[model samples]
Target: MEEESGLSDVLPRDLASLFSDTYTEESHYQFCGQQLRITQLYGARLGVAAPVWDAALNLCSFFEEQKLNFKGKKIIELGAGTGIVGILLSLLGGDVTLTDLPHTLPQIEKNVSANILAGCPPNVCALSWGFDQVNFPQDYDFVIGADIVYLKETYDLLLCTLQHLCGPSTTMFLSSKMRAEHGTVDFFQHVLPKHFNVDLQWRNVEDNINIYKVTQFQN
Candidate 1:
């Protein structure tokens, strides 16, 4: 299927066919020469419909291009709303931990189990931004997140969590849609830079999402 600039621009007929009353859909995709399946739970009040967000799509493609070696590496995705990013990494040989709110774990687990082999399937755990401290092995080589910066209230907590998860060698890949609301970029402008060495990696104009590759700066 050809990529559309954004979901808002879905054609009338296409829109009807794209959605389901069941609020769940199976998406088939190929990444790095491997066939993968993603089961997405949509229309949930608790942010389950994030799989279609442009940021997610952009990050998926961005990783395919970069093809950073994930084999035998420890990777974790914060706010793994649909578990797509981590699932992809796991498919590429990374030991992945997909973390999200408790309510969202089932969907993440389903996607992971369906795609990853049984023995070493990606770990699906509950992680509340700024609230829960999960006891997973630390020093994650890569921390990934998408569209996780929507709320200003969670900015400090998110940063603190990232600081805890990221060591000097760890790299964080974040994709956020730029909101038109005033001060939407305030986190990027004021908070993120104060903590990490941030670099803009990619921007998808259709969805207005900016992808940043960041690493923690030593104090």
Candidate 2:
């Protein structure tokens, strides 16, 4: 999720301002040997789901760097702001679902439509963490998220949603920028460990971004 001041009413004003660029109407990214032109609504009242974030870019780079094949895999991205990560994976041949709150779907849909180069275009849906998770299947091969764990209030809801979506064999890739104010480090180190096995897959030290590989904790 992109940083926003109003998201939970806890994000600091200055921190939100750092990621919210009002002048950037679109963002271009190159991944999977393809260029992606993503439409962004940065200044819109859409809160945190409008613009692209560094965590999303780093996650895409991590996938490409690891040569992870998404061919024919069933994947879903939670809090898919701007739909950049899912769009890139879809281009790599994954059947990707990009989901966020109802009000945020239009922007994600627009980005998905604008970047449908080949293979199946990613599906866009409204999924409010724990609330509508039942509407989605739990058989996904992969569950992915970018910068979605910032709000401490949403921890349980996010955990509930993750439990519903991840099967025993499913793997999750969550990329987050460590923000002391937002308690992002606590979410990865303490909260998620109780139910999921979390491993640090990659770290962009300069950017303070960490990509974690997660899976259900089997008894």
Candidate 3:
């Protein structure tokens, strides 16, 4: 499949074909039975070109259920592929910056627009990830990432990006699915202590589905 740049009514349908069997034109997620809308695909399941596997919705459920108050907070989401979490956070009352590689911006923007239930929330921009590569707004109360640790080499870049934007109160909330023989857990364990108070919120230790809730960011 070629990289797509704009939202076409048929684009989601086309993406559905590529990730067939794993994709659904419509999927619903429940945030305390409030019934949030989501599309699920093995990759971009929502017919939306977003790269989120159901993990993004799971993250949203966690925050919503926990009653996270992002009110008047500066927030950022790294690897915001579909922009779902970032958009939802904005709706939950935070100022949000949604960033990903430039190419994925269109899908994210489309998803953000499409999934907004009542009216649109403000979203800042789509950017590439690099330390100080972009200007920081300062005083980040929280940062988030979902299923972003897909490569070992990207580890350092991810941490550097986190350090670049976060202020003292920042909490990095991450959700990931562990793939066999993948070093994501090792990567998290290695760096969590350097910047956060790490704890396993839930780990399907048998199936490799893991959720980590991190807080108290240092430096």
Reference-based TM-score of each model: 0.84, 0.91, 0.74
lDDT to native, each model: 0.74, 0.85, 0.63
TM-score of 1: 0.84
Q: Which ten contiguous residues of candidate 2 have the minimum total lDDT?
A: 2-11
Best by TM-score: 2
Candidate 3, residues 1-219: lDDT per residue as tens digits? 112322242234665456444534555555533444544334433333345555576787677768878878778887776677887777766778777666666656666666665754657465445644347665778887777765555667676666677656777788776653456667677765677677877565454566676776454
Q: For each predicted model, how many residue pairs clash, with residues at least 3 apart or on different chains?
A: 0, 1, 3
> What order do you get sorting by TM-score, best first?
2, 1, 3
TM-score of 2: 0.91
Model 1: how far residue 1 lies from native, Å: 25
Candidates 2 and 3 compared: the better one by lDDT is 2
Candidate 1 at residue 153, lDDT? 56
For candidate 2, lDDT tens digit of each residue in 78-195?
9998999999999888999999887778888888888995557888888887789999998999999998878777878899999999999899999998987777898899888988
- Residue 4 in model 1: lDDT: 16
Model 2 lDDT at residue 145? 97
lDDT of 3: 0.63
